[model samples]
Target chain A: MDLGALFGNFNNFLDFTVGGLVIGAIYALVALGYTMVYGVLQLINFAHSEVFMYGTFAVAWTFVLLHGTGDASWSLGRAVPILLVALVAAMLMSAAIALLVERFAYRPLINKNAPKLIALISAIGASFALAEAMGLRDRFAKWFGLDDNLANYVAPNKARDVYSNPVSIQPHGLFHIGGYSVTDVDLVVVVAALVMMFALDIFVRRTKFGRGIRAVAQDPEAAALMGVNSTRVVQVTFLVGGLMAGAAATLYMMKIGSTRQNAGFLLGVKAFTAAVMGGIGNLRGALLGGLLLGVMENWGSAVFGSEWKDVVAFVLLVLILLVRPSGLLGEALGKARA
Target chain B: MLLEVDGLCVNYGHIEAIRDISFGVEEGTVTSLIGANGAGKSTTLKTISGLRKVRAGTITFDGKDITHARPFERVLMGISQSPEGRGCFPGMTVLENLDMGAFVRKDRKSAAYRSDLDRVFDLFPRLKERERQAAGSMSGGEQQMLAIGRALMAKPRLLLLDEPSMGLAPKLIQQIFTIVTEINQQGTTVLLVEQNAAQALKRSDNAHILETGEIVRSGTGHELAGDDSVKAAYLGGDL
Candidate 1:
């Protein structure tokens, strides 16, 4: 470990911190999907990672459709419209996939009164099936005789990393904090994520339908007695979570500039960790957990090595589970502030 | 009859909780099932509220068969339940909990809704005092009041209350029966399940005594209250 180097280089630490916050914002968005599904169903939607993965692909695909696979830079004015469209595309795609997963993978079991463990296994299976389906898009497209026409979307090297057509909104330096530049990309990601999180928190706390979600999460039978349609509530929860993940995907593509079929796997896991760290079912807890996890992971990489960044996240997760299983905020969605 | 249960049989995995129990709740009258804990009073209420599947029975509400209706459908059809154990969402305020009771009402923002809220407050001023307090943090008596008040928010034509006097002091039990009577007089048909025979029987217009899983006796509340056998078995041989 290079503690001496980490302490000696204050500028490097600030840069790492900003970078961590940027990625952390994305994690918070994805984690809401995980936490919300858990809140109502009490099942860890293992396939949720694939939902984010699909959304990232949607973002990439939307960019390709709007602005061919060119590396040419565009002015901010021209890029803004394309970015907005891509955001909507990503949201619709992810929300559709999330609803599909609920319908095909989980609903049947729920209808049959299947055990929760069985549902979890089904989620893991669905996750694999979704990832593999994306990975095998080339072969699937060839079977349908559309490979030649859709080569840009699914062709040579379909399984490998796919880059979005570059919309080079260069990271203009907004300010300097301790000799480290705070770029516009960091500001945009953090602010956009915060806006989405606050909107969701308000919806869950204040709105009537939002109250229905909380009511079902707390007591399904009681909610039914009070005339809350729990099935509709479940669908809405999945939809809301998917929308947040889609927004996160857009921000991620804006910053990272690329995506792959399986990119959601690692990031999804990281977001789940963030959810657990914050308190799995608490909305605001996700925000706090994601930001904290990002900063800590980045700091750990600096002290140790960059390769050990993932290790830092898992280690923190284990520690949190052992010490505070309920998480930093320690409240389920049902018990959160009214 | 506002509600009728004919030949109702409910089972929990082959163990009959309620066996061929048939009763009718008259409109605007309080009907009570007074029995021991394991005599299936709760199961019968649960079946009527659509929480439990009937093995063999027909439950007709306002002359419409509701044997297979979902719980929420029953609520929309003007049936509501203040379930056993006062199932209040602990994370929400008393007001939110009450709001949940009116979940199916489309006129929540109207003056009708406001008057309903006022009625609940008038019925249990204690709930109004702790309107913003979390339902879970309240005393048991207060939660029970909230439960009944919440059921009222549905403006139900027929109300099902399971064990409303289950866990309370003697004084509170008397107070609850009084409110139950009051709510019945206000044009709501009440179906009550209780272990407190004296209080329940005194307030009920019609009463059934359940034993094991069947109704053993049915009479006017005054007749059952005056019966020697009922007094020996349920009322400690005296009122």
Candidate 2:
């Protein structure tokens, strides 16, 4: 561990913190899906990683379709529309996949009253299936007799190869604070995530639909007696979580500049860790956990080298679980709101 | 009849919880199913409310066949239940819990709904006092009140209450029975299941004695309350 590298440079520390927050926003968005689904079903949607993965492809495909890729100088005005389109495309794609997963993979097993472990295994299977589908898109295109140009543009030769955003929005420094720079990308990611989080919080706290969700989470039987359709609530929960993950996918591509076939796998694991760290069923906890995990991992890398960054995050998770099994915010979604 | 159940059969795997049970609740009446533990009282209410599947039965509520209806659909068609053990959302505020009860109503913002809410508060003023309190933190009796209060918020035509007096003090039990009578008088028909036979019989207009998944006897509340066999087995020999 290099002590000087860890704390000697104040400016470098600030940069890492800022970068961590940007990444944290993405993790928080993906984490919301895991936490919300767990809140209602008490089953982890391991396939949620695929939901995020699909969003990344959705955005990339949308850009390619719009003819917005490859060495194109994108003005702020022109980029705004393309960015909005990509965001919507990603969100829609991810949400669609999430609903499909709930409908096909989990719902049947749930309806059959299968054990929870069975549902978990089914989720893992669905995750792998989705990941492989994306990884073998070129083969799929070939089987479908897709046009060569379209196939090359959408699937590419190597599915696992890094896919870059065609219309790159040049990063402009927004502000300088204490010799640390804040870029437009970071501001967008953080601010957008916070706004979405606030919107979700309000939706859950103040809206009737949200009340139904919390009620189902607390007691499904009682909620049904109160006229809540538990099945519909579960579906809505998956949809909302997927939409957030989609938005996160867009922001992630903007900040990190590339995505791969297995891009969502590591990020999804980190987001799952964040959800558990913040309390699996609690909404606000996911946000807090994601940011905290991101910042801590960056700080760890600064001190112990980049190789130890993931190690530090996992160790922190283990330590936190040992201290507070329910995470920092605790595990009550309904209780927390109340 | 506001609600009718004919030959309702429910099973927990091969073991039957309820079998060949038949009952009816007249409009604006309080009916009680008095039975000992494992006599299928809770299972009867659960089946009616659609929480449990009916292996063989026909449930007609408001003249509509509802045996196969979904739980939420039953609630929308004017059946609401305060399930056994005061199944309140422990994490929610009293107000939020009540709001969930009104989930089926489109007129929740209307004055009618407001008055309905006020009527509940009027019935149980303790709920009004602790509207913002987390329901799980409240006392058992208070939780029972919240549970009943939550069911009332749905403005149901038929209300099914299972063991509202369970774990409650004698005075609180008496108070709950009084509220049940009041709620019945307010035009919602009730089907109550209780272990406290004496109180349930006294308050109910009609009563049934269930023993081992079957209705062994049924009569007007007064008639059953006065039966010798009922008195010996359920009413502690004196009531």
Candidate 3:
């Protein structure tokens, strides 16, 4: 009945597919962090998106400090060095933030054996606290002593301005391969995500510390009996997981070229969905799930328009759960089947 | 003494599980706690292994006070426990479970525990056959063997076992008891909790009888097993 509609703009399908793959890679990266922490702790780390958001804000703020907060202070030529600094700063910020969440919020609840609801409340509280601490633009600026400086940076008028440039945010400049054009930023995001994912896989599989992690994930009580320092193991898990979220945040900022105050919220939701799609405790599953979800959302958007992208993930998530509650790979929270 | 528990008490919220329980395990000896259900036998082992807190008492292992230690810290202090109900990681492979037994050994790469792993495999040859199989997927007796082997991997100075004979066939129970003796002879001190009174008493060097959160009798295993009241109440008849 709709043969013309089906055949129309077939090339658009290819473009959306490639674009979806890139987004999927980012989701996979973020999802792996979620999966890893969930694998060991059995807590959702509800503030994890805050961890990612902090990474983004830290990188952006650090760049401002390094390049001076306003127009004509820096050039795109300095991208390489600024990129490194942002990554390192984001990582440090995320690790510190995650550790603080663990120390102030989760650890106490765990000690008290507080019901699951309490932990969830604590997570939500922590998320709100962290988000508001930075989102109340004037208050954050005052506390951090960057009020006037940031205001000027984001002012409506400036030459070669990053903050005040435009209301619409879109990636530009593309390198063509055959008939397809791939932007440098998109390539960087995709490649960086894949590279980090691969490295993380190797670290988990090849290192002695990785074995210790798996051991704890399998049975923390038993692992403790073997002289494995359970506390240290948990801290390290948070650190590594935080680091991944940090890297993903940086890539997101680079690809999107702008980050809203609550940017990590939607990204986090999608990534968490990806994690569940793949199986919450399975590492490779996170990666596969992220890609599948990204592709599904892209195709959905092509058919139904951009507003439906988020809905696509939700639909897939519900369908997957109904079909296989344990997820695509069948892992439960924190207990690896090994 | 390899290990000692003096006046150990434990409470499960409002209910008192154990009160003023005392026992000692000599080095290279099998010390057993035998009792009926709800008699605090497992509770006593849990107190020693640091899984349950001691409300008012002391646990000393090789001259170190461990009453206030954390559970994992107790493992580092050379106390390993194979908990009641076979607390094996069901999702993990048999070999992975064994590797976890050696979790506290930082230098496992160069120790006899490495070879001891092989010995465990030899003792439970069925496990070796299913080394790569998921433990939760295994039979009940096999999971029990995996639990014991995993505990042994800690190379524990004092091993606390809570009901090793639970949920097993009589033949498997005998095999587990024999393994307990073999482990004791291999130089690890053992504190065993069991409901298999006759078999436990026959194999243990020393035994304690618990009834309703209190220790009512203590002696060499033979002495307790030979007691007329013990025979009547626990052994099913005069022996």
Candidate 4:
């Protein structure tokens, strides 16, 4: 709509492009959770959003515990250890929550031979319960009589936005593409995400557990005939998805600096959108969909006011569904073994 | 006996697939269950391999009661099946599919693994040719061979094969039966379910004729093939 402004400000467009890619990397990581779970279970785990949310809190709390609520940035030497600690914390917490959901919420219904729609309803319920439990942490802490000791983690903003300790490492200049200076933060985000993605791809393609997942995905009965325990495969699927969401959460907190109890809701929806856009059960498709969505959303925001960013993203999703419902890759996890 | 099914009954949501079926598969023998469609031949094999629930009676394999065992447990207990319709993992390469067959074995790096792999390749050289190709993209005959070869990779004491010749050409079917006979000769007991009555009867040392989920007749391969009634009903009035 505003082509003149977009063309006139080419430098701003470049900045937006870089920024989009950085955020897109996070979306891709989170989208892996959706795609992998769908690959094995053929169910959209609405509760996966909360898995990411818990990870974001883990990252924030790890920072709060390591460095007090101060605006002091850590030097590169000091930050590396703390960042690694936070990453592990976030991944572990998220994976635990994901496994819990699988065990308590989904497994019961699955064992009962319940319909997919019923499992979906259960996921929605689990999602709400998880978000609400985080939102009501202050009162829950009081019930445990540890509210005063854990005030930093539970207080002041139980139901509101919680800010992470501003221990952000200042970004140095990295390289420039097309006259746009890319920062170290951008490189880290993109590189870390890509490494995780490739690691997951290799694990799925080469490992024995990965083979079990693909077997179950292709044919559960046949997989059983091959001696693959479908239950174990399902657990591994959830755990892997959760780990990726946690990784995304850490990157998101690094870039955005704050989170809410309900933070994962919108982002989870967007990641699911990315998964669908890429190909619901395909690994590479999630990465492609996330990056494409981010760049297009940014461009649309610039052209038609920032308010229309979500509109542009959703409209793109609708258009993609209309044109190719199977997604850009048009292959499920079973067929995308390569 | 390598595998025994005594008074086994299986149901598919109230429709009995197999009823009161009792049979014993002697070790190192090719035992065949010949029948028309819906006669429960496949169902009987599926129940024995632990894929289907038995509503009544017990399945004892190598003298261990496996009636309530899980499918994976059955495999671990040295019983493997190439299920009906040749249930190959379509997304995986032929080598990967074969590897999956040996999933229960922790000795993948041992010489036994190599020998099993070599044996499968020796049995069906076509699978070795398509080692890196996806199983789903292969022809039906090739898929059948891969399915049987995959089952063999498990190194089972007994192999349960369901309709290995279902969709193959006549020549391919003959080749598959020859391999089946060869596999039996190489010290693996076989329980084969087939609609190819003539071919099954020719190869089976002991054969049973199933009708409406029950065993209507049991005899040696020569006895049933020589019987005039069986020749008219199942052998199309000749051979």
Interface RMSD of 1: 1.0
Query: Which residues of candidate 1, in runs, are more than 4 Å off?
Result: A75-77, A160-169
List lDDT for all candidates, in order: 0.89, 0.89, 0.80, 0.89
Error of 4 at B68 (Å): 2.3
DockQ of the candidate models in sequence: 0.83, 0.84, 0.60, 0.75
Best-matching candidate per TM-score:
2
Q: Name model 3 segments beyond 4 Å from true.
A: A1-7, A70-78, A140-178, A333-338
Cα deviation of B55 in candidate 1 (Å)?
2.7
Clashing pairs in 1: none
DockQ preference between candidates 2 and 3, better one:
2
lDDT of 2 at A117: 98
In candidate 4, what fraction of native interface contacts survive?
0.76
Chain B TM, cand. 2:
0.97
lDDT of 3 by residue, B63-151 (tens): 99989898878888888988887877776788877887887777778758768889898779999999999888899889999999989
Q: Candidate 4 on A198-237: residue-level lDDT in tens?
A: 9999999888888889888888888888888889999999
Better of 2 and 3 by lDDT: 2
How does model 4 score on DockQ? 0.75
Predicted complex 1: CAPRI docking category: high
